[model samples]
Target: MHRAPVVLERAADREAVPDDVWVELRRAARELGFSQIGVADVDLASAEPGLLAWLQQGLHGSMLYMERHGLRRARPAELVPGTVRVITARMDYLPRATSDGWQAIAFERLHRPTEATVSLYARGRDYHKVMRARLQKLADGLAERIGPFGHRVFTDSAPVLEVELASRSGLGWRGKHTLALSREAGSMFFLGEIYVDLALPLTPASEAHCGSCRACIDVCPTQAIVSERRLDARRCISYLTIEHDGPIPEEFRAPIGNRIYGCDDCQLVCPWNKYAQRASLPDFDARDAFDAPSLLQLWAWNEDEFLRRTEGSAIRRIGFERWRRNLAVALGNAWRETGDAALSRALSEAREAASALVREHVDWALAQRDTPALEPGS
Candidate 1:
């Protein structure tokens, strides 16, 4: 059952949004495609230590932006001046065509070994654009009701600790995989935040429900999840393919399987995701090109075709270089797993014209044909 809309109470020195106003905010957010909304106080002092520890361990890989922001990521008031409260939102992103047993379906993609498995999230339009525009509209609706207030919006931004705010504001609990997970919505949704000067009443946080389940930790392809709520991103395929600019690490290449972009193995195995919801908007619908594409098929795309096909998609942001690099690694894995001559031919053909970084990966991929497969856990 939906939690009743929160009642706003007057606090000294700040205008109190009426209970009816809170109802209007909920209505506006819902109309804007937000599944849930909650307020979190700006004080995130307690989360700073964990953020610092994660960065100190060099687990963030080459994503220096996480360290550049420092503790400001935990302290909302520091990142956005005068922000007294954060309005956190969640929007489910599972494509509407998602079927029952979707997790099993995702697992089946891995078994194919030759198919290019883009993470489900990136299979649709760029969610950063979709979520930002909707968040701004939600903010505008709030302004229309209570007059203009100081506010800024963020969606998957580096400077903001999104899961920290989302879990603290009753959106969900931070799962063992370190992504926000909800009992009702699972971990499949995207999160956004509006930093506002208003001192809105804070919502009670959600309780941890992961229990004794270690499915996420056990299911990771590269063991990126070192422990509960701890991730070593250097080994994470998502980080390597999308964020890391260097050659895909040899240790992780084979384990990355046919995932040409981000990996969803953890979320795919989480039992709670059985409750994942379908998106209310068509903006997240999967494009035909991403639905079970082959390694050679994607590798066949020249830079121009890559640019044209990935226009307005999140995959484009990685640029053609990393795109080819990731494809090279996946093609290598496909060749190793299937011994398919077509994949080997595609890898060799691309190597001739590939950039230095991509060519190195292409060379590595071609060498996979000569390497014998190791037994599980070897």
Candidate 2:
């Protein structure tokens, strides 16, 4: 049923939106390519203590922004003035061609050691751009229906507690690995939120389905999931490879394997991921460059080639230095696994022209030549 536009005299207040508006909003969100939308009240005071505890434990690693924002991350109203409710949305990001037994295929890549494995979510377009743009369009559609209203859209922003909002809004439950997961979609999705002044009906939070399931915790290469729902980002491969700008820690280097961008082992091991959905949009299709490219192939690219190839992709955000740093570490692991002499020669050649940081990593990688060799898949 098509409804007439809701005219408002000024920006919406807590009592402004009717129940039907919520229904229309969901319909519009579906039209705009979101898989689910849920409403969370602005009062997130209950989540503050945990947030503080995580920071106190220094679990956020070098992401000083988390410490700077502090509890403002929990309080939506403080982050965005006048926010009475938060609208959380999730978009399934698995590429359209992700086939059956995809998890096994991903696990197989770990055994090869030479093939660079970018995270499935990052194998395509930059999701930060895709989610933010679509979220804005969803907000604009809402405004067209109920007239202009105060709102802001956020996608993986530093100040937003996205997983909290997602869990509270029934989009999913918090997995033991600390990522939001749902029975319907598992953990293969991107989360975005819209903070608004309008009061919307809150969706019931989903029940935690990870009961007794420790697959994610056990599969972690670095044991980053220190405890249930508690992540030590400093030990996390995803954090080390992408967020931390300095040298890759020595202890975790061999465990990193071929994951050059982000880590997906936890998600790949989860039993529920058998039901993970494919993206409805073609924007997430994996480019040929990331389709099982080898460590040597990636190592061959110069800074200019790296920039040119990664122009529109999220991999570009890590920059050439970190990219090379991660590749260096993975190359070292590959040498240990296969004792490949070509990899050693490449690492040696790159070291002469490398920066101090990259040179240090390359030297470490060259040192791996003396390490005892192992059979593939061992």
Candidate 3:
């Protein structure tokens, strides 16, 4: 699937790439469902210190791969030799059927302890599949025009600093939550990159718009955002539910609430999200099952059913063990909050049949029936 790298025969060959190529690429990107596209130079040495600090602090938790990749993440040429300019793309992911006041609806779900609250981005097909295919297509279209360039496409698949490249290329600015934020598209979009040897015109970086806003930080159920742009990923709910593979930390269980997949508290509270755009492609539309699934409803699924239901979803990546583990914690929280006999019954019935990890969580959930349910965010 790899193409031979492009080689310049002479010094003049470097200038053969048309300067107006970006204008045509942007038009092709829009046709392929990307919301915006930009070009970034590959000098990311300025970002290496911050990336090193984050990793050295053990903020990445169990993701040892981050430590393994090291500075190669900051150097595109090292990862893919000959990378000079990177093409960055943004694609909005809000479900096309999303209504007005969607943030309120998200907040409402958090208050309802028995309802399963998945992050908005994961309610549809796996974005890795959706984005990777489109990105490859975008690269193919460019090859058609520019006639075979040395390039490689990436979404969240690699160690490249997505937000840094994104912001540098005028896609958006880094918001308080450390997510790339655009005035026009907000933070509810996915980012992808194509590292190419072509010396394309660089896109100007956008200015920071979050003046004094602390909504994203204050609204975090786990306070994962330690400072304006610094995040402790270990404490992030999205990381807890999706990345951390072992048992859910006891401290974050209750605050984790009914979020079985990822959390969107920060994005939900951001004022800029009021302008969040919906998906141009139907691939991001929410399935009927994930829309308003209840705790017991999801709890009823065995491994086989779990696989069948989550076949093409990002949720499937967690596998049934972690999936059940997350569900058990949410169920425990639900048992304490409502003391619903059915919730208790569901947990008890699954206890003996569950995996060791899931069984432990199930036992913890059953114990919640005795503890007083604290108020949300208390």
Candidate number with greatest TM-score? 3
Clashing pairs in 3: none
Report RMSD (Å) for each prediction in the order shown: 4.5, 3.9, 1.8
lDDT of 2 by residue, 158-181 (tens): 499899899999999899999999
Cα lDDT listed for each candidate: 0.87, 0.88, 0.89
Q: Using lDDT as the measure, which candidate wins?
A: 3
Model 3 vs truth, CA RMSD? 1.8
lDDT by residue (tens digit), candidate 3, 1-378: 234354322223466467667788899999999999998888999999999999999988999999999989999878887788889999999999999999999888888999999899999999989998898898898889878777888889888999999999999999999999999988999999988878788879889999999999998888899998999989999999999999988888988889999998899989999899999999999987788999899999988999999989999999999999999999999999998899999999899989999998999999998887766554
Least lDDT summed over 10 consecutive residues: which range in candidate 3?
A: 4-13
Lowest-sum lDDT 10-residue window in model 2: 1-10
Name the regions of candidate 1 deviating beyond 4 angstroms.
Answer: 1-13, 374-378
lDDT of 1 by residue, 154-187 (tens): 8886488899899889999999999999999999
Which scores better on lDDT, 2 or 3?
A: 3
- Please state the error at residue 221 of candidate 1 in Å: 1.0
Question: Between candidates 1 and 3, which one is better according to TM-score?
Answer: 3
Off by over 4 Å in 3: 1-13
